[model samples]
Target: MTETFHEFVVQRSPALSRTAYLLTGDHQLAEDLVQTALARTYRHWRRIRDGDPEAYVRRVMYHQQVSWWRRRRLAERLEAEPTERAGGDHTDTTALRLTLTAALRHLTPRQRAVIVLRYYEDRTEAQVADLLGCSLGTVKRHAHDALRRLRAVAPDLLDATAERSTR
Candidate 1:
């Protein structure tokens, strides 16, 4: 049986949101990514319903994000220190996530996408290349550059990972 577009969204939105968050690193951008992907997918719903619709949506998201990155050359931001939340549970995991998010911000959009796809999504290099519509060499280069930037920005986080791996 084929799934309706609305049903597919209800079932897949959470997973899509998580991936979008990892790809964009900001909640608003993640929501926009999901929204944009779904809009694009809906345009060909009948044709894609019986096929791999989720994959199609994801590909749209990746393309949209990369396009956003290209347009970002015209955007500017004013940085401000994040206000601390009072009386919240602050844990090592929370700290690590914050540091990782910060480190991810240092990478280019393609590099960030490569890191999220390769590590967070647990995709193989070839699969990531296919999804990003880039060559294997491009994926490898992005992954390499992303990791080097991460290590430079968050050495403690990388060292902690290494320590855990060796244990």
Candidate 2:
């Protein structure tokens, strides 16, 4: 049996939330992104019920995010506040994640979206291009530029060891 919209949301929210979080890099913004996508999806649920509603919602989110970024000409910048640590449990992985987040912030929304789709979401270049409504060459350019920017911003994240080996 096909699932209801509410049931679909309940079952898929966590995965959607994670994707939104990766796209926006803020918990609150991620929640808002997911909510906005879901609301749009809800409005057209009847027509899209037999189709891939999840893909439709994700496409809306990607387009919405890109449109907002274009209008704003910048992503939202949130200052990190100091927090009390319960113990000395911080590790290298935590530091790496922080660095990666900061690097992602430096990328343009389109570049970041390409990176997320191509690498994080494990989508092919053609798939990303199709989803973003761009040509495959555009996807390749974005991926190249994003990687270049990321390498400049966080050399450690993009296979520094491989570079060293080649050199």
Query: Candidate 1, residues 1-167: lDDT per residue as tens digits?
Result: 23588899999999999988877777888898999999989989999988899989988988888899898842422233323568965886676676677777777779988998899889999999999999999999999989988888788888766766887
Query: What digit string (tens of lDDT, one per residue) describes model 2 on residues 12-110?
Result: 899888888778877787898899999989889999978988888888888878887888844589444323357744775565666677788778778
Clashing pairs in 2: none
Q: Each model's TM-score?
A: 0.88, 0.84
Best by lDDT: 1
Every candidate's lDDT: 0.83, 0.81
Tell me the spans in candidate 2 whose CA falls farther than 4 Å from its real position.
1-3, 73-75, 78-89, 159-167
Error of 2 at 90 (Å): 1.6
Among residues 3 or more apart in sequence or in different chains, the pairs in candidate 1 whose N, CA or C atoms overlap within 3 Å are none
